[model samples]
Target: MSGPELRTERLVLRRWRDADRVPFAELNADPRVTEHFRSPLSRERSDALVDRIEAGFEEYGFGLWAVEVAGSGEFVGFTGLAVPSFEPPWGRSVEIGWRLAAHAWGHGYATEAATAALDHGFDVAGLPSVVSFTARTNVRSLAVMRRLGMTYDPADDFDHPVLPPGHRLRPHVVYRLTAADWRARRTG
Candidate 1:
């Protein structure tokens, strides 16, 4: 199914394609890219994730958009909204997230793409708020959350249900952006 596409001055956020699989897999397998995760993804697992990403769009009319550079059409990575089905406190929440290739790092690509996704959730989907969570040690991601105007409450931090108890990455911090806050930021 065809999904929504969003364009920025330098990037295009759109549906996945057959051509994106290889590079997408490479991105997922990169050590630096997946450093904060438990481990890098195998090709088989990477392919499965693409299938799920595509299915999300078909089911929800929105999902993580495959991101590419606007002028050169380079496949960077993905950034968009997702319904994270985890556990209590975070289950069934709309989340904005992203993953870009190592080459795309430090270029503000994540911030740009994620802002579009957050805007889509707040303006198009009419969501009340969107949340983003990452490992407590992932300072880069936390920076992006801040750049997107998401606020953090130390009390909202929690252990990720999917992660093993006592795992190094289990502790995560949540950031939120409400519709009212988004509007005020945009029009104020």
Candidate 2:
């Protein structure tokens, strides 16, 4: 509870906990869950990722939040804001994203969690905008971005710098949503 906590109708987004590591690791190792990534992660790498996420929360007061179901308290996955390590046209900026287990998909959990995350970015963080990007082939995430009312600009497309050129996951598309736009969407 040292960090920010966000809630939606059916979800609670809060700080990482030790109990979340095993599920988080399983999520990272799932091929269906990591379809957009270069490859599945080893448990060591996954635990390291959890460490980084916790560090981000400690440093930024905001980071990829560990999401849970409201009543069941099941650790679904993560959804929230982070500063992308790689530089793109946007420079250093916060991005909203989500990653849930395959069992948690098709239930609008990602969208529900992401909606709250965007609200936090615009309202709590007072950020002008939040961005999200993924491989062009990632239709599910693209749909979630659209559901969050984020817009796509073809010109903003860029090959993921972390991915080698010509890599299958290199081609990526960018989506953006501004504070003003989020406000409008919330009201209108």
TM-score of each prediction: 0.96, 0.97
Candidate 1 clash pair list? none
Error of 2 at 175 (Å): 0.4
lDDT (C-alpha, whole model) for all candidates: 0.91, 0.92
**Location of the lowest summed lDDT over 10 successive residues in candidate 1:** 85-94
Per-residue lDDT tens digits of candidate 2, residues 1-188? 59788989999999988999999999999999999999999999999998888888888878999999999999989999999988887687889999999999999999999988888888887889989999999999999999989999999999899999889999999999989999999999
Off by over 4 Å in 2: none
lDDT of 2: 0.92
lDDT of 1 by residue, 86-129 (tens): 66475668889999999999999999998888788888888898
Residue 82 of model 1, lDDT score: 86
lDDT for 89 in candidate 1 is 78
